[model samples]
Target: MANLVIASNTKAMKKLDKGTKDKVWAFIEKLSADHTASGLHIEPLNAAVDPRVRTGRVDLHFRAILFKIDDKLGDDPTFIYMGTWPHDEANKLAERSRLRVNPINGVLEGIIGELDGEDDRKKRTVVPDPRGELDRAIKSQPKSYLAERFSLADLTERLGLEPDLAERAYAASDEDTLLDIAANAVGWQGSALLDLATGLHIDTIREKHGFTDSPVDDTLDEDEQILKALEQPASKMQFTFVEDDEELRRVIEGGDFAAWRTFLHPEQRKYVEQNHSGAFRLSGGAGTGKTVVAIHRARSLALSDPTARIVLTTYNKTLAADLKAALLTLDPNAVIADRLGEPGIYVGGIDALGNAALNQAGNIADAAENVLGYRGAELTHNRTSADKVWRDVVQSVSSGLDAKLATPGFLENEYVAVILANKVTTLEQYAKVARPGRGVRLSRPQRIAVWKLVEAYRRQSRMDGSLSFPEILALAAEQLRLRAEANQGFFADHVLVDEAQDLHATHWALLRNLVAEGSNDLFIAEDSHQRIYGQPVVLSRFGIKIVGRARRLTLNYRTTAQNLHFAVSILSGAEYKDLEQGEESTDEYRSARLGPNPRLLECDNAADELDKVADKVREWLGAEVDPATIAVLTRGQTDRTQFVRALGERGVDARALDNNPATVGHVQVLTMHRSKGMEFSRVILAGIDDTHVPSAATLRAVPEEERAEALLRERSLLYVAASRARDELVVTWSGKRSELIHSEAGE
Candidate 1:
């Protein structure tokens, strides 16, 4: 009997037809049970670097490559599943491919040197390239290639990259060339080359690949010592033993990196498995696996105790729905409760959870009266009603206050950021509280006037019978605090929050109070650049401190390097902050994926733009890209309607995906705001023109002092939409483009 393990870097293995994959798994299972099975037809390869390397028949079309590890102790046998390939390809692969413990770095790796007839692929890759390989080469002089930046000696001696593979990567003058090299590379070599080509620091690469500062050891250098080599930290990321049928099936079904829920990079796994003392914050640019970490953290907690009351939440119900779906995807057996305060996992919007908790306590009106000065207003999650209340209050107080100070934006910001945040119930407390992040300064008189305006807004909201979401959060927080003080159990044993940046101060207070303050009390994921709602949250003020417990993910797994650059450009010139007030940087972030630089389609008018969107979508469909995986995002709902009508007229079925799950046979069209928490293989950011982006009507509504922040939020709105793209991003506009998007190429 032998222990069989699946190699982690099996991109080709994942692409097999489901029928072939099932047979491949069966082949491994049979081989593991009895390596000398007569019908298996496992034959040793004479051309292999390691004599034990062999190919076993998976079927007539495919052969499985396996490495037999002979334990020095004469223990039970062990085997490695290199992957399944066509008969000739498998035989050829066994000849050149060899697993070894890098003499210089100690990391175990596999190299597939120039396979038979690979020169044709070297000349031109089938990968998506807008420009041909020759043009891509011309765009890059030798100085720009990874070879020029890194010496061959460093690649070999330091990183232990196979010499021939290193040379192929060295001559890669363009991203497409690197893509070709990466495609041909096997196992760890493939991932390392792509990361190096993108200009990631060499030392960081060493650390990521499990290389340490210790001097090299010549004692354990044999390739035959496969069992010992598999124990290396590098091998930990690349190989996992196949103990059962389900594990093997899950492995062969999904591609590398695409199966983020299953395959976490070593760095990411550390965060998922590590323990934190108190509240922990994980921040990253878009696509950097912040949400992935959050979901896994929730899973880890639930797996620890299926009965531990755990609540996994995000900014809104739409995002919460996505999180719930992802939670199940990660673990189908996970228990998801339909309501809050349950013993199993409860995934919902943070405010929704708070409202539910308050309702469970059986006195929503009384709770509102205790926190807010009144109980008449009903809690409303509707943003429209909240905005209208702010507008009416501002209009009512316009005569007594300065025009700049009477704006609804300014008033609502003060009420949420200062009044509700600090629990200032009196005029004196409002006058005494500091307003650090607010754009405007207020004197004692101005503070009194602002307090009067907030009072009026509350009174009007009561008369209108509509309480804003933030007010409901305030009520919930006050009630939860009282319960905890009187020795009531927390709402949940653990709480996890994704997209923490968009939460208002009151929301944070409620979340902090929802779970008792202890280890793993709060796990927060946010990208400050994605803050399109409310004021920047200062966590300490809300009694949730993350002083030292913080981690950041720098590698993006979703969008290509090209699309990420385009999305990051939209965030240029805006200063972003973390959960704390410290600055958040997007400078060092890198994506392993590569593709065509973002494309821009400029039109003369909105009507013309809609037609072009349809044509471009048709072009994509003609290329065999899945229609369901393409998204066209608009700046407003009106644009969403026009695109839908235009696509329908052109005979392309398009659905307006408004917080709804995607369906088959239609391309999804969403507003930029609605596109949050959703991603597509191809995305078209429609209506990124000067008028629609900044929303000429929006800026006028913002007060003079707060215009800059409002404009930054507008930029963030587009950033969120653009980053939702996974492979290709296309920008389309009717008139002059928004100044936020610079005219430059990426990747």
Candidate 2:
């Protein structure tokens, strides 16, 4: 049967009135079920540039324009471009449609071909060829850099542009001009050329576009090639059948434009469906679909092996819950729904795994409320009870007459970031261990003093009969490793971690020991640019090797170019690294769509800022953007509470995000920390000022030497907050704006 594909041009549908849209949906349903139904005249348009352009009647006054898919691939006539056209404009619309594959990214794009007329030429003189201007700019560069190292053939072969255009480009000037014109180039043609010239790997380029090394025979004709392309499961041109009517209706009504997850980009499918021998790491920037890949990979494993046990986890509860909900959606027919929660596939936060192990070992205290001696001292001032212990017990313990020892913050980090993180128990182990990333130095006497502090903290933790979250992870890891050595069975055969950057050092250790190091043992996806908690970890220390098994995804399917650019600017000055300690950069990252520049709202004071934010939100609601697609992000829980209350007072039914996975139907208010791994159509980052962004408490807690690290973490937090926006971003400030905001913005 021929397939029915919906072009990603959602704006075309949005331009119609509701009554017309409903009629259009009815037409599509009938066409998908049976294209030959009476009253549906599906015939080719003679005026179209592409021979495959066709039109189908929706009503006497309205029609649906479509592109015909080749029948040799399948007997069913594959139709795309489900745009409703008025009777008067049906022929004009069909004539404008053209189908072609982007050479750089291998995506099938439905473009409106350029029209030619004397009148049009006259109108175009106002804006000269932006490409010509670019050509002139690069003419000043060294001749060899343009003509010798790179050539016109390279551009033609890389971007899959017209031979005439490539010839014109080559005959014009230097390679620098070609590179300079990249921003002005139409569609993927210009962007891919620029990326190629700038040193992105060919493999990455092919992966981004859904191309594989195994090629279809070159002798195949155009129709045959297209048929082969559609047959491949990962092709962007491939169609997914929406069997469930209610689900189909929900997808259209909800404005979920990206289509179904079953149709994945080839690279994403490669990661999800391909099995690896041991460990694998996938890293990408915000909106790169890392979490989506993790979810699909879990389903893939379960389907491939009926007896397989899989655990899908992340750093926090909210995100894990999100993953579980998404995973459930993979079963469109409810085929595997019954097998999800047991020995088949398990999903939860990584911390829950530690708790489970602790519970199994019977080590955690069930009712030790007063054992730690911190229950009565008001722990709200610090980050956690552990922070208080570090300040009061660890920092206060020192040598000399008046306790004349080094500053205790350094010692505290030494114990946690280095010692306990690496399972260092003895003084000798602490002394000999190399602090590769640590900036502070310590002498023998200082080491003794710090070790003594560490010993005191351990003793107190034992006496309290309670363990911090990190300590639990460490103890669980040790217990699991011991069990593995003694030839014992583990909980899950496969483990997949999403948002791996936020995991603590001991969590990494625990994950490493969760199962024996073998086929499909661990798969982790993370981006250091989204690290809002804990410190960077060296994966080699935990025996997870990613030397040749790592992949970087640079194309962001979510977030617009405008919003993504602004979000990336926040981290441009900061350095980021992967779990394996390799330096990571986002210079090559690009977004799928272009949108309006993010709005920066500056108000007189805190109250004024809140009022302005509410006003803008009201405007968005008036514009008919879904309330569920809007979110308000704040720096801390207090700010979240304030914003939620203020928005509620203004008649906006806003709800603060909590443990529940679903956040639909109401405006969501959440802290930046809680906003990780979530995206929205519109986002408002409120109270992004100097004090609240970095949080005065966070700054005061860090040692002076590690202040830069603290700021970087804050910058990452702001970056994550800003990037969650898909189409629009509004960043507001009250008194002093955050330095994290790009200087060019708000002018």
Candidate 3:
């Protein structure tokens, strides 16, 4: 008797499982005899269960039944069984049982499982019928639309469901049931159902026509096949989206050149053409492409003289990287590297280059000691010092000195002479300069007395060097004077200084040594309208000859017309009274327009103002604007940090521009001073109120005329800030209105 029983009512035989197995076997024998009696041949038993089945070792017992089925069958034979197991577990067990049967039978059964199942007559089944409900749903859909084709994975993603859930929905018995399950699974709506239906219709059509075979013409390309498919109305379904491969290819190629051209501006191109001289500065408006020019200029110089060493250094390393990328693109053969001493193009920041030079000269440690005394040396050794040591030095120098000595007014006169004369390369040389020069030379007693004064000042101020800022200028000037006396020509062929307006008298004296008499290759680019830092150092004092050599680029390409106009109105004072103004003749900036009218937002408090700014950013994003184009300008780093934190809390992408180098894509949030020469798409000038603007009483400490000039510099900074915006400008403040704004508005 078979241990595995096939019964019509499986649930009813639980109480007499052993007896039922015997009864089932008897029934099978009787059926075989009946068939023989009716003049039909009966095949031998295909399979039967073993009676030695045990609970725990049921898998082993089931193996015998499967073997009988496999050995007795001449060809593939069907078998059925009744069991009490979880549906999934039971299916797995049934598969295992079938595998242990005839190997050929097992293989055929696996193939059948892959096909899902067939009707009672064993014909391959089509996709389940929708029955009444699906038929109604299909009728409601437009004739222009069809069912969609999607994999179970695609359905899972679209529906935001687990993979298993989507798979179960797909395996539903009928179209109506599948739709019902999917609707519940995915929270179906009008558009969602339409999308699903479209996928299904495509799938059904593909299956019905057996469209898996490749077309006969093997020589035809994929694009040609796609075009051929499009030609057939049935193949070109209603919802299919197509792309023109040829047009797409052209567009991709065009974008590369466009990006390249944008990065290399007109000034940059001109600079590249006229690349000569070891030291030349490329200074201009921010987007006027100084960095780009520097890159190509370096490349051109490298090509002209392969052995000529070149260094492309900026105030920012990121900018240096950008410059390096531009150079590589211009000359693919150019050997450039990021590290300082690399054989090719060396790119770094100003300080980095300075440090590199100092390191090579073995003077960086000495220079640090001279500028910052014992504490600096300790900090240098430990590498844990705060970065404001220079600022502290400047402050200490200003505080201990006589008030008259502290004035910048003494720089070009008394200061320039002292700094020019004081260079002690060795300890012996320091003894010679201990005395203040009397007529031509000093007596021993007078020298000792002067040395005592110098030593006292050095101890009190905690300075390593005896020379002050003015003394440095004096010493540098004396170097130039002595060089002329000796008839030795200027060391450099040409001299160019960037941010020329910020240079003080001492700076000028040092720079003078680079271009002595008969040096005509002096090119300086200075925008008097953008000197937003330091004391009022006159450009005229450098001599009008230097000013005459400068060529002006007056086109306001960075900002839109409205922003430019507003900035000009604010800064067009007596100093910049004769300045030429116009738009840049470039296509990039030609059609750019202001998006909104510039406004000044005022609040009763700082925290309230911050909340308002956050709210505004959220509103802008909601209006479909990209977060990258917005910027928030502040007076200091403190404001920047606060604003950044507030914006972050409100889920806005905000970054403090402090210490972060500017890139082409970033929305720069910087001080007005830092924003000099740089431009943006949209600018927000924050804290433009009384306490911040016009500053404090420090302007009074400066001479009245100099103070006026300093105020003009502030106006110039405002001009730069306002003109940075190529599209929209926003000015925000708290408390009293900024005097500069009021003055400009009145004008």
Candidate 4:
């Protein structure tokens, strides 16, 4: 049977008119049923670059290029590229194109024009042209001063480029043109070369692109290779079959070629398609498609086992909603939708899942009254106010321990970061526990004193029916453990976790208990660089081991290069550890698109800053950017209210984000913490002045010994906010600029 596949890169689709798109769909439907249908005018071109290449006439002036699989041409033609081009140009493009399976990840890719210089040199027959300057420089040195001697073949293999292009790159005698060549290189080749040029480690580059030193299978026949290609998921392929008319309409209407819609990076696809013996995790920086992997994994599991019950969850509700929507978009047959919220598959916030599991086990009333300490309807009305309980606990502890020691904030840090974080309940465990990353040392006497204060606080809070978020999670985890001790089976067959960094240790424990330990038990997607929430629990603490099953994504598809550089600079100097205890940073992460630097505005005061913000919002709205696609974020809740009121006063329709809507005519206003897992086309971060950012209250609340961790949290918060902007970032501040902003300027 013939298959109609959309090309991996959909940029060509954006240039078509609605009438032409309709024609393309009609042709696809006919082609799917009968490739030899009359009036289609499909014929092989004599001058095509590759022997298997052919062209189909879309209309009088346009053409679609197709790459047929070996001798199986008529039956399995893959549409790789389509657009309005002159007949000669279309043929040339087809002639130059080459199809090869990437050795690293076993993915089939179509490339236009071999990277070798022979073909290009043929077009421009000027002998010893000025462009040869770069080629000549490399000839003189043979070895680069920045790194070891790399031959053309080595470069081609490492970058997955054709030998000619690699040769042309080596021929470059000047750095400027070589830089330009690196910039123009498409797909992973450009990213790899840029990283190499920027002094990133060779091993790091190889790992990022899924390159390995191990030998690949060189004996597979062409037929065998094509069969393998057919098995690969759409997320990892550049060319895909749209299959149905509804899917084709979605493709044309979605605008820019969305990777989320058509393809997945190899690493992401691996987690989706491959099964694990135990727990597995996918880790990467922002925009690396971690959530995309989690969504696909959920659907994949459901499709593989119809009787399987799957739980897809994340830390926050807004992100969970986003995940659910994306899952539905990927679900063409409604397989996931029909099973969602049922016994087959479930999707929601982790807290929601926890509550559901507790309710199912008939422990909800006791959990509400005892574990969470709520009375009557307060259990329903005041459920999400657990964070406030933690704050109140901090205040009470700070005042109680003030007379014993100068700064008592470390006690709160110890109680949460050490005790509650590790599920430590008894005072003996608290006194002997090793506080990694806490930076404060306490004698046994001091530990006892701190324990006395914390114990009193806990007892009084229990009497008052108060519980912090972490405490609730810990309690929930204990409930699950109790159920398990009674030999109760796990609630679900599989659990997939997104935004895992924001989750507390207790949350992981609850998740660990929700699914039985076996193949495909846990799928975690996390990036510590984007950890705005202060819960940094080691995964192994909850018996969730991912030693050899962890993967990292390096390609950034969301933000522009300039914007990424600025966002990364904001996170400079702070070290973040991943769930596996590995040092994580976005230092080597690169972006495909480049844009103007983010604007950093220094205003006279709050009034002037709000006026400037209004002007920027008005400009973005005028540019046809969707109002909902634009966001205004702040460091504090008070600042969020001020910005929301100011935007409303300026006649801009804006709403504070309690939840991110599917579509909106109003702008979103949110605190930096709330904006963690979301993305926007344009973002305006206001009120980041020195005093407001690391608020005086926050500083005074923490002991001097624990100030470094607190400061890093604030920096991470800013990094999260800045990274949420995909295309443009406008940072405004009044009075003294933040030290963090100054640090960014330095980077």
Candidate 5:
């Protein structure tokens, strides 16, 4: 008797149509219970280049290519389901494809084509190196990191890895080396790497791939061995396996990216399960699976202790809702807590946490005033909300001052970044505190004048009984600190922050007090290049230290190769910083997949752009692509509204994405900001006109000296929109295109 294992979702399985998929599902369901050659049309393929390669009839016309492997220790054989195809195509595929263990890394991989050097590629043992280190140390080898350290000949032997992918990965140069040597090496060395560079120093690749963590048990059947590797994804990794019949169905019916939630890239899985002494930061470019790690991190914590008091939070209510949804998707049966510091996982926006804590403090206004260092300060009950509320205060207080110093933007920056950030209540403290990241310096008299504006803004907020979101966070942090000092409040055991780059300093202060300082207190995920809001603040300034515990994810799980290059070029010449105030690295990053170059359509006006958008949408729909997977992102609410109206007139039935479920029947439209933490199969960034992008109103408010910095944020916003596209992207503009848009590298 032999065992049957449905290898987890593959690109091949995803392409099968419904009728064939249903048949394949029925075939596997029967095979799992009874894998007899008679019950199922299973037989050896005489045409296959390798005798072990076989074909099994899924239905009358469809046949699945099954790779048969005998247990290494001589036990029952195992049948692995590769994919389903037409009977004729399945025979052609089995004729050329063979599964073999890489002599260098000892990882099993499937390959097509002839082996160039049959004698040179000697088999290596499955035992890993004793170093027990990550691949980061592999880069010490210098030029052509992997090529210099390991034999490229042995790497391409047995045709395990494509020769071109190996050449590009090991080749030397400033531009081609966009992907980091270590990140790319380990990234591809796993199941994903069987298609790329598969050769590395045996000692390094073995240890890096988790062989050192635990050696493979050869006495067990091959199916059991692979199951162990996949189950222990963090400690030891190999294949993507579907353990049950339901997962097989999920793989067979691919859409909504459900399979991705179950199968993680090994590199991402490492971060999800790694431990650190204090705060740890995992930052990566858009689509590198940072959010994926955040979701799994919550589950890992809760599974370790069901009552761990884990709070998974983000910047806004929308993103928090998304996180909560994703957390539930990861584990639907787990109980979600109703309040902060409760058992199980609690997902919510940081501001919501502040409101809840303040409400629990008996009197919200009293808690806020005390945190402001103005206890007994007259406060009103009205809560009016507004952005940049310092224009009138600056105009009325700063006389004979430089116009740049008196702008509402500059004054607001001083008030939020320095005064409130430092909890300074008096004008003397404000005048003496240092202002970092502020372009223009201020004289003592000028500081005194700015202090008056800050005071007035605070006074106005109090009178209206409205505290800014930052003020709410500051107040919440104060309450947490006071309660912790008395050792009474039940605080979070672990706090995981996603979209960390957009959080204000006060947000970090509250998070710092939410969890006690110990091992694995905080796990942060962010990408500064995707930061669309909130100014950058140093994490250490708020006492959340991440000095030595940080890792950058360099492999992208979304975005095509061509679109990634285009999106990255938009960030050319811009500098970004990490939470520790260190320069962020954007190089050595690589795309996991490739697609057609992003389309740049220039037009006469927005009407013409919308016309072209409708044409593309109609064309994609005609081809049977799911409408729910198509998105049209815009620069503003105005453009979002126009997209919906214009597409409806064109008979596309486009709908704007809101809190409701309008996902299936219509193409979705959304402002770029609303599109964060989301992905689509196809995207059209419509109406990127000059006047709309880097919106004139936004730049008009900034001081002249800091315009460059403001311009960087705008580029980041565009990059964020471009990378949301997973398979294809089309950028359209009217009149003159935004100066921020850069031509593709080759163009």
Candidate 6:
């Protein structure tokens, strides 16, 4: 006499308001009483509605009843809409219909009823269910005992069936009847039932249950058969190469140039044809297939000698991933593994490779200990005493100067500026100038004063017990020198460096030690034009050949010819003088067209300028450009607060790229220094005025020789900013024009 009670909106049932709960209870009670009166034996219709539906456009409602004698009701828990025609349209349809079930669920139940309506409803068919069939099947075959071991309670709960019904279904005498009950219990049909049949070795049920078997095994072959099947496809490795003897014949035989272009760069193709290598270095621009040629070269070397493993290495993980992807495209069967902290066919990063070499020689630990000890000594009391002796001499020089010129405040200010500028260099030089024999010695008070200033400078720069960048380089060089002197050639088979132009003198010395014999083991690729970092490579001092054997690629493919031309014209160098058009036509590509003509907007103040910038972003969104493509390039993070705040006010999706700890977000407001090697569809170089563009923060401590170089780097950064706009470039300045814009504009 068990009956089911179906509930809707169960999630919100516990949180329903008191009044609504009461009404819902009353409705259920009335339905239950009506069901009993209709000659259906019934228990209480236990129903509940989610409180979330109270505020919803439609209310929670449903109708249910218990039935005896197993009368065919088409589908159980069927939904019916009881509202009269048009007047109730404005009202919640669910509430007005009385049975406030989700329309989608109601429609599904109705469709299922329609599907079942065509069946023979009068014939009360019954079969020996799953449990009886499984028991009999398992008993006849000892090997099939695993089927009988299944937990009946667990299966009943899993299938959401009554215990007796589940047991009867599981123990059916006929496998076909058991399978139908199993499929129905699990709500599976078609491919799912086929999967079940495959797992259980029950394929005969396919014919009995009137289910068609889909041919899914056509593409899937067993691994053992793969080698044997390859015999059928004999010409899979066939390839066509251009005949150098007949250039005209090859042009006549046409195929996709894009695929060929991927393997052969113009210079590399020429080099391969000639088969010559002197002191040549390929200086291909970023994305110019430098890595492709490197892989081809490595593969060619490997082909020449199967035993001679070629080592390929790059500066970082991203480059390593790129190189690995390129190699896989060339030869999918080739074995490629990471060379992290170890030597392999392919290694990565100069630091990693160097460390690997040191580790192999069993000297890394000793070298690290030596360097740490030397650094530690500088912070010791004995070292401080030695440093104080020099400080006293500096005070004597300052105290001897005329009182009018060397007043305490004036001397302090000048010394502080000089210290900040030179840092390590000036301190070492000042010690030489203030040697012990230098006559007019300092008084005790003056000695203490100078020592105070020196200590203050050291503390300010975080140089109390730590090595400077230059000192770290010097120590690393010393270790390499020591190793070289011991005749321990701890060298890599090959060395590859990225950002080569930024390497300092000591770094070049380390590179020299890495490839001591100069046996074509070193590959360096760099552009002097993009040397934005102040540290320039002093190639002459490193004892390397300086022939013009380096490959120079000048084509700018990332940006359109118009943008490229503008960038080269504006940047202060002859390096980018010969600007050429990119491979693809800029006009055809809608995403990479010249956007709004560059504008130099002048504003009354920073606040007014931010408001205008915010308005521009809103207008762009109105025009249907994605917010993700837009970026605001500023001088620094501190200067971008007003602009970012204004954008927020206007409900624009904007973020300060400098402030974002991780590299994410769509709309970015970034500093010029942080915007290198990154691009955007629409770039806005904001705060580009005389005062703001080259602010005191950027120009103050930079040396004279480095100023032009820094400005050139800044120009490169500007180029990077301008080129980021695939479709558009916008330059906004305030007050007086920036030197760069004024020079470029010829004003």
Top candidate when judged by lDDT against the true structure:
1
Better of 1 and 2 by lDDT: 1
Q: Model 5, stretches more than 4 Å misplaced?
A: 1-5, 9-15, 19-100, 110-151, 154-238, 241-258, 361-370, 376-382, 388-403, 658-662
Tens digits of per-residue lDDT for model 5, 427-506 = 77877888887777889888777777777788787676677766777777877777777787647899999999988777
Off by over 4 Å in 1: 8-15, 29-43, 70-76, 112-114, 119-151, 168-187, 190-200, 214-233, 253-258, 305-307, 337-343, 361-370, 374-384, 394-399, 460-466
What is candidate 3's lDDT per residue for 1-747, written digit by digit as tens? 221212122211123344434443443343322322332122222221221111111231221111112213243222222222323333333332321111110101110111133411121111232245434543453322122344443433333223344445545444444434433321112113323432434333333222333322346543233333323222211111112223222222333212332223233344555533322333444334444444556666566666534455433444455556556655556866444434456655433443343333322333333333332321121221111332343354423443332343322222222323343332244445432211123345533433333333445433442334433333334444455556864433333334444544545544454344333333344454555644433433443243333333322335544455556666543454211122212121211122344666777787778777777767766776666677777776777777778788877777766445554433445677666545566678888887776665546645443567557666767766776777777777778877777444322
Ranking by TM-score: 1, 4, 5, 2, 3, 6
Tens digit of per-residue lDDT, candidate 6, span 479-550: 565677788764544445544554445455556555454445555655544555534333544555535545
Alpha-carbon shift of residue 578 in model 1 (angstroms): 2.1
lDDT of 2 by residue, 169-229 (tens): 4554644455544434443444454455446664555556555554454677755665555
Residue pair clashes in candidate 1: none
| Per-residue lDDT of model 1, residues 1-747, tens digit only | 788867765444326777887787688778877888987888898867767677899988899888777766677777877778888888877776666666566666544423646342221111122235434443452664765566655676677666556656777678768865774665566667767865777888777666766534556435344666666556665776665666565666643423666566666666776778899888998898888988988888888888888889999998998899888877777888777878789999987887887766555665666667665646555432766776787776743677776777777778888888777777877878888788888888888777788888777766666667777788888888878877877778888899888998888889988999888888898988999888777888778888799877877878887888888888878887777999887876777677789988888887888888888999999999999999999989998988888899999989998867888878999899888877899999898888989788888877787788888889889899999999898888887988887888432
The lDDT, on a scale of 0 to 1, for candidate 2 is: 0.69
Between candidates 4 and 5, the lDDT winner = 5
Q: What total of clashing residue pairs does each candidate reach? A: 0, 4, 24, 21, 4, 15
Structural similarity to truth (TM-score) of each candidate? 0.88, 0.77, 0.48, 0.82, 0.81, 0.47
Please, what is the whole-model Cα lDDT of each candidate in the order they appear?
A: 0.77, 0.69, 0.42, 0.68, 0.71, 0.41
**Number of the top TM-score candidate:** 1
Colliding residue pairs in candidate 2: 1-76, 2-76, 2-77, 105-209
Model 4 per-residue lDDT tens digits across residues 1-747: 465656644232226677777666566566666777876676776765566667777777666767665435434655444343445556666676656665544545565542244433222111122235534544664554332646554564454444445656666655444545665654555556666655566566666555645423567676457546545442244555666767766775664344576666555666678889999988877787788888888888887888788888998777788878888887755455333335556888887776566555545444444433342312231343433444455566643444424233455556657776565656677777887766667777777767766665666665565555555565666666667777977777889999888776568878988877889899998888777665477888788988798877766778876777777887777887898888886755766566567899989889999999999999999999999999999888888888889999998888887565634788999888888778999998898888977766786666676677677778888888888888898889989988777545422
Query: What would the C-alpha RMSD of candidate 5 be, to one decimal place?
Result: 6.7
